[model samples]
Target chain A: MQVPAPFDYKRASTLAEAIALLRECGPDSRVIAGGHSLLPMMKLRLARPEVLIDINHLSELDYIKVDGNTLKIGAMVRHVTLQKSHLAAEYYPIFAEAEEQIADPLVRNRGTVGGSLCQADPAEDLSAVFSALKADILIAGSYGTRKLPISEFHTGPYTTALNPDEILTEIDVPLRSNTGSAYEKVERRVGDWAIAAVGTMVRVDDGLISEAGIGLTAVRADHFRAKEAEDSLLGRSPSTEAIAEAASLAARHCNPFADQRGPEDYKRHLVEELAKRALSRALNRSLPEVH
Target chain B: MRVNMSVNGVEVSDEIEPRLLLVHFLRENLRLTGTHWGCDTSNCGTCTVLMDGMPVKSCTVLAAMASGSQITTVEGLGANGELDPVQQGFIEMHGLQCGFCTSGMMLSARWLLDHNPNPSEKEIREAISGQICRCTGYENIVRSIKWAAAHSQNSGVQQGVEA
Candidate 1:
């Protein structure tokens, strides 16, 4: 019989109306998109906002499209939509793969991208996926819109750089040619949070690694990324030895705490193994096939 | 606040508190107990209902958010006193032992059949992955969904039970 503490609820029919309500409600107010993450927190008394601005009616913020070299995704886009989007699969298969592993279908139907990123749970899969993709997020406020790289969005666990009055409206992912990405997670069960997950993106140029991004989640990796691993793979051929060394670097850089999931050493070991597998798969996908 | 929505093709309105969850609203206010409430968290699918023709965990959704939206519960599955193919399949294939997870499972199966008429066993399992049946009756549940897919067109006609 869990119920949220008493609070005033207001539904905003438009984005402008929502921003107006946010400005009026002040910092004690919070915007709820899907209510999957926020409501559960409210039930536990972890989050007790005085006012909840429901933004589900702002359907204008729900879309997935490719413009120029960027794949722009609306904040209101649900997890199920991303998992089923052919455009997302073609450009970055990591999104679809990670979406499939984020909760189950019932939760996916209502869980929005904005809500997930805003929640900023350390174990959330999309944060790692977007971090690996080096995406940018658009935050809309009363004044105007501002864009911030996903790496700079999160300041701490369950915290984002978003101001109380600002609403995240869109996620922008840059599309790269001859690049491949993959997400690997080790969850205790189907819908459980990851013990340690790794998302890797690799771009090969002329048989050398031009760029690489390795993002880790649930392991307390700084900035939710493995910069040491990324630097180790740059300007080098993604050979077996290079990949193994880079995976070890990712494992060495993480700081996982022991909990019900497993001990710290075990999670760090998973970070190493999963990072290696993701890097290997990404490299395989990036390289052209030889007949 | 006043929330108005369509439940099972019927328009309904209620003056519910903003904190009222859609699950409690359905059971307490509207007396639609067919939508079971289990595991207040979104882990269990027993509280699942169709919101705009897609299955969503009702426990996590506020009734206020459902305003002007269409919701379909197990009570709305069959029409004219006839069972939906999913309902009949459950009965014939013994998809339930305790029957606590029946409504959610049947509704999810119905959604899957509507979208994909010929889903394999793996697909059926994946479709209902969110649902939890403590009775461990998943084998028959899979078979029940298959039965509905096999007899989707003429669910009214009873077919001979296979030996």
Candidate 2:
């Protein structure tokens, strides 16, 4: 039977209390929201934190709303909420799409967006989706709150830029008009981690691509994004040829490792194919049909 | 730590270790073995139970985190010694062969039918996709959930008999 090693558990009633607990528990402590990712790791002895501060009772950090031109999502928002949120689907379809593919419904009910992003698994879907949207993450520490671009959030696999005493509070996604996004993933089975997944967002203006964002997962795209591909799509029409070129650039840039999921070359192929499919769908949504 | 929670509508309190999983808390501590534990990882949904009316894999949840929540196991599905519609439907449709996955499947079906009275075949399949039945009796399971959806309004007093 798999079980976590004995540790002290602390439940924080408020955000301030949670922060204080984190500081008091010191560096060997960790904050748990959903505990889906953390508990499993604990069982395997992969993550042996001396103290676990449960933040589920902090209802203040569970929300999805619009503030001016930005869509703000609280860190404690569960994956099920994101998947079922009509507002999320309307503004960022990639979130709903990716949330649907994250684990299963049972897991989604308890798994929080904050935990997923903080876990920083290379195969995690939300990281790619947020990376494509160029979202900013809000972190709170004893000192104060700080915002970090999603690109700089992940320092490495299973790691984040968050300090030991800090907690990620919210995600800020800049809303854009005439923008459409889509996520495409290829998993071996239902609820499995992606072999390779791509999330694409496009902003079309006057029949030209004003801006584009391409994010890849599992295939290990640098910073979870394809900067060269995104740059190539800028100022270009969303034609099949232009999209193919950008997709090729995206495939060439990612560094996938060979594993039980697939070989490195197969993952590279999936990156190219999924990127093309995601870009096509995103462009279709951004531009009105001529016919 | 001292944990207090409602299980099957009964208020219970106990002193438990922080590392104790909810599945163990239910099975060993509370002696509610109806909620089966399978594939300690969250992949298999056999350990599923209703927490605040939503289905959650109990194996992945710490008992400490569920201290104040209301949990409904398969044993709580029926009241006054009557079977829940889901339990009756499982018998009527032969939803189980080995019956290892029956409890979790029935609880999930009950939650789904409560939220969506009439789910399509695809929806029912999707609802139980997290559960793994080695007997490969998913067709009967789908039919069982559909049967429950149809008979949900009826008072389910009939005794459940395996087919």
Candidate 3:
């Protein structure tokens, strides 16, 4: 039977209490929000935290709203909530697209944004979606709060910039007018992780590409962001040639390892194709008449 | 650790290890074995239960984390010893071949019908996409959920749901 090692579980009523508990419990302690990712890791003996501080009761952190031009999502917001939030869909449909492909509905009901980000799995879809949206993450630690760009949040696979005494509190996506975003993933099954997926955001100004962001996942894309492909799309007309060229750049740059999903060449091909489709959809959505 | 939670409308308390999963707690501690335990890794939905009225894989949830929460297992689907429409649908439509995945499938169907009284075949399929059924190939399972939707709409929603 898969079971976690013995540990003490503490439910914190307040964020301060949670942080204090984390500091007191030491590095062997973990702050668990949804626990979907952590618990499974624990069961496999891959993660052996001696203390778990449950933050599910910190309802104060479970919110998604627009604070001015920024779309702010609380870290504790459940995946199902994120998938259903019209506010998030209004700004970027990528949230729904990515959330739909995260896992089964049952798993999504218990998974949280903070937990997903902190887990930092390379095949995780939200990281690519948020990377494409150019979002910022707010992390609260014993010292104070720190706002880090999503691009810099993941230091490596299964790792983040969060400290042991810190908890990610919120994710902020900058709302841009004349911009549209989409996420495209091709998983082996309905709920499996992506073999290679691409998320794209494009701002069309006067029939020209004003801003472009491309995020790739499950293909060893560094920081899950394709800066070269994004840069290639800027200031250019959203044309077939331009998009294909950018897609080729994204495919060429990513380093995908072979696995049961497919060979490296096939994954790279998916990266190029998915990137093209996502960019086209994003460009189409950016046009008011097209939408 | 001592945990208190409502299981099937009854307040229950149990002394459990913090690492004890909710599935194990329900099966061993509470002896509600109707909720099947499969794929201890959380990949299989056989360990699903209603946590605060939403379907969650209990295998991945710690019993200690369920303190003060309301959990409804497969045994709670019926009322007054009457079979739920979901269960009836399964019987009438032959939704199960082996019945190993029946309880979790029924609970997910119940939750789906609760939220959407008349879900399309596509919607029903999407709702239970997380669950694995080695038998039935899901064709009859989809029809079974549709049957539940029809039955509920005809007889009206029984057992007022909170949610």
> Candidate 3, residue B1: CA error in Å?
1.0
TM-scores of the candidates, chain A only:
0.98, 0.98, 0.99
Residues A38-156 of candidate 1 have per-residue lDDT tens digits of 99999999999999999998889999999999999999999999999999989888998899999998888899999999999999999999999999999999999999999999999
lDDT string, candidate 3, A1-291, tens digits:
889889988999989999999999999999998898998899778999999999999999999999889999999999999999998998899999989889889989999998999999999888998899889999898999999999999999999999999999999999999998999999989778899999999999988999999999999999999999999999999899999999999999999999999999999999999999999999989997974
Docking category for candidate 1? high
Task: Give lDDT tens digits, candidate 2, residues A1-291.
Answer: 999999999999999999999999999999999999999999999999999999999899999999999999999999999999998888989988888888999999999999999999988999999999999999999999999999999999999999998999999999998888999999998879999999999999998999899989998888899999999999998799999999999999999999999899999999999999999999988865641
Order of models, best lDDT first: 2, 1, 3
Q: lDDT by residue for model 1 over B25-73, one digit each (tens)?
A: 9999999999999999898889989999999889999999998999999
Output the worst ten-in-a-row residue range by lDDT, candidate 3 chain A.
A282-291
Better DockQ candidate (1, 2): 1
Native contacts recovered by model 2 = 0.84
User: After superposing candidate 2, which stretches have Cα over 4 Å from the reference?
Assistant: A289-291, B154-163
Off by over 4 Å in 1: B154-163
